[model samples]
Target: MSIETSEPTGDTRSRAAIKNALGEQARALGFQTMRITRPDTIQKAGDRLLTFLADGRHGTMEWMEANADRRRDPRQLWSEARSVVMLAMSYAPETDPMEALARPLEGIVSAYAKRADYHDVMKVKLKQLATDLERETGDPVKVFVDTAPLMEKPLAQAAGIGWQGKHTNLVSRDDGSWLFLGAILTATELDPDPPERDHCGRCSRCLDACPTKAFPAPYQLDARRCIAYLTIEHKGHIAEEFRAPIGNRIFGCDDCLAVCPWNKFARSAHETRLHVRAELDNPPLADLLPLDDSAFRARFRGTPVKRTGRDRFVRNCLIAAGNSADRALLPFVAPLLSDPSALVRAMAVWAFRRLADPDAIGTARAEHYGCEQDEAVKKEWDAGTTT
Candidate 1:
């Protein structure tokens, strides 16, 4: 079980030098903060993950269940790893994201997804840091962003970056809740930093702020009811119960993160690539609803929203259009009634009913129902007609 130590075991000066150099290098590579931790620092994270999986709180994300072993123990994923370096890059927005919720005509996207994907931006920076660390210490290293099974948050907490807040997201006094985490695991046995202590005392802002009641309790999340999960992850029809509460949010929800008291201390991202594109910030429902598959790909090419695909993204737009009450969006929603995706067509039916009068709904039903083949879309027509 013994691993090679890059720095001499008893050499405090060497350890301090390496740690200081790493912090300097990481900052130079665009990381706002960095900390050192051991591979085995997150035993509690593994236990919590097992409980989360057993409770089926992760929804359709079976990858979490499949990688439980490697995720629980970083050493299991890579036995040769001796120390892990955790890094954070702040993507805090220039304006409050909650403001978008009030504009019913616009589809609110989560702040994180409004910019170029963090996985791509963070990985390039993370690899540079890992390469430098390996060359300097002669240690083998592996880098990861969110794509990996490695528990970056717990490991970040263990490395003193931040504590897991009541919303189960890492919150920093310096950066608030707007940090993207990255990890670099090295086979160098370095000294671990002090773990961060919980600072979220008596605060329920994040929990009370959830639109879908995603947080079952403090420090625990039920992904089944999360808006982010429904819009971005879940592929099927969104349940009837969550649609109205979803409001104008078409991509992902940010209520919990935006309402956090710590965000007052947050700063806007300085990295150009991380800044939200002008077109994506609270764009109109009319603007998004009309996008075809080709247009959708052209519009969201480099962002994470593109990964949600055209059908689901358009379906989300229909939800926004229905809730908007603007009625001007009817023109945009009408064309989608015959959208090739049953998911889109079903939602178009539901949205059309909410925005259209009873006579309009009856006429539209007579015109569109006979040709509809998907049972799900047919159910929407039947429900809308009955109501």
Candidate 2:
């Protein structure tokens, strides 16, 4: 719904009226809450981010380092941006996400990714709100949905939306950790809300719950050890140390988010677009193991997992198969030893050895190792023979 332009009263009262109208419109567009803050509200966030990058904990995500200046402050992102509107949408699972962890044969996708790409879903809503803001204030606005160099979590906290919990994700008292954040940076001035303070005092469930000990301390994440990073972002062979701990998670990790005690308040998403699609709800490892390029694209198109590409996703599935020890998956995995992507082939070797007996490993290695051109896959073949 578009806002009707009206004559401005005093500056404070005009901004207040615009904020109230925007709040109503944001709710109509399926956002859980909307709060306002200034572009300069998060000065300390810049310093904290610098430390994170200097420590090299961001792993291979070099974009964070390159965009550090813009991310440090919203003013640097857009010089004339006078106010930021931080918004939240819920994507909480209807069922316990932990239940999927026990379904070892089924690959576990992070709850948020079981639907279409959130960027596409939320951006449409944000653009509508941006149009309304432009009409009411007669100012240009830019929208973001976890994209670009904007530091959304800090912006959310500054806007009174939530606080950064020990897991370093924004956690709301009302919404728990199930929020997807979006922002509107406008050149118009709006009243700012009081910032939310950290409520994670004495709570370490999110830290201790990590399978790979990705947290070196409360609130600090070592992304290199994070399962989400290993499965989705890290392109090379996953370190052998992390494979078993990765379990059945194919696309991302939800352990830290799921264990937050604040989640007891989280409700299933009110927006159907944020709900898990039926096809992705219980993706069996058996079905996922053999998806070739075209079939993979056809299966995962419009979903976040598709961006990782088939070879990388298949590599994650191979890790799950190796850890599964179901032996039933061996038939599906055997053909991948000759898979064209060296990333997939190397993982196929490791998975083959995990399920195959020594005699079976010797047989498979003799057939594939002789012709294997990739040095990494050759190492995997040799390594599997011993292990």
Candidate 3:
């Protein structure tokens, strides 16, 4: 395939001007860093993800399997795409992200979700970047954050943003795991940067810190066992074995990311809007258990927590409440036995048994148990009673 050379006029000079202008524009946009990368820089990442999907490790995230060709090659996503510009934003917090686990009894929100949803925050930046590029190059462009079928981690890795750590997340030697990734696909063929090399050698901090042992191997993850997947992605009853390990992680989990030694180099986030809200940071499980659907939506608006919805999120809270052993939460747990959503009711019944008197369990079994018709609920009730 032959490549187009300069027009011998000013187009050649204009393209160079655009490339330099892009870096200057990105720097002015508060992006911690940005790099343009060649298309094939991401091929190895595609191979790794394809292997992961082929082995069925992605679990219920069927989109990963559905977009095989597009994810493996950026050209397949958009034929006009000539280069990918990967951008990174820092979200590092002042306090340790892992401190929530010490309480074990308090709910732990993922650092990314602790503030506003990153999709909302990063999408604005991505759009601005794309708009600037389009204006300069006079060519069409598309922007993507976590929303598109494109492989973000791989592209970010290829663009010299960072290497994928053993935890399988893009991690910068400068920013740790506290960065959010964004990308802009443009038709202009910009100069590409050299890719970063893997620096996770012999380090097992992330692997050893996982509560659920979600990593089956280095640079691979099993979503089925990940707390983040279970709490937010996997609906219905959580697996029995993982409940204890989940602790009070009511939304997504960050054990692996929080434990990395590279975090010492991370700077605290300058965006005050990304700071943790006092109400949500380490909130007690009891405060979250009784939020009705509308209340839940109202509370989590602009937050990533809204994705789980009331029923699924409350179900997660009930699991934490059951494991709390506080006994005080039983009163809060009892009323949900008749929650309209069977998933909620099922978890409530389990919480009741965990925090209720054995006699109360028997009484609940006799009076309110018939209200649950879902097979999964009935099974949890039966198992709880037997235990």
- Winning candidate number (TM-score): 2
Worst 10 residues of 3 by lDDT: 1-10
lDDT of 1 by residue, 1-387 (tens): 112236653477677777777788777777889999998889999999999999999999989999999999999988999999999999998888999888999899999999999999999888887887787677799988988789989999999999999999999998999999999999987788999999999989999999889988999999999999999999999987899999999999889999999988888888889988977888888888989999999999999899999999999999988888777989999899999999999999989989998888888889999999999999998884422
Q: What is the C-alpha RMSD of each candidate to the true structure, in Å?
A: 3.2, 1.2, 3.8
Q: Can you tell me which runs of candidate 2 are displaced by over 4 Å?
A: 5-10, 385-387
Q: Predictions ranked by lDDT, top down?
A: 2, 1, 3
Give the winner by lDDT: 2
- Give Cα-based local distance difference scores for all models: 0.89, 0.90, 0.82
lDDT of 2 by residue, 75-169 (tens): 89899999999999999888778788888899999998999899999999999999978877779999999889999999999999999999999
**Pairwise lDDT winner, candidates 1 and 3:** 1
What residue runs in model 1 are displaced by over 4 Å at the alpha carbon? 1-10, 385-387
Residue 127, candidate 3: C-alpha displacement in angstroms: 1.6
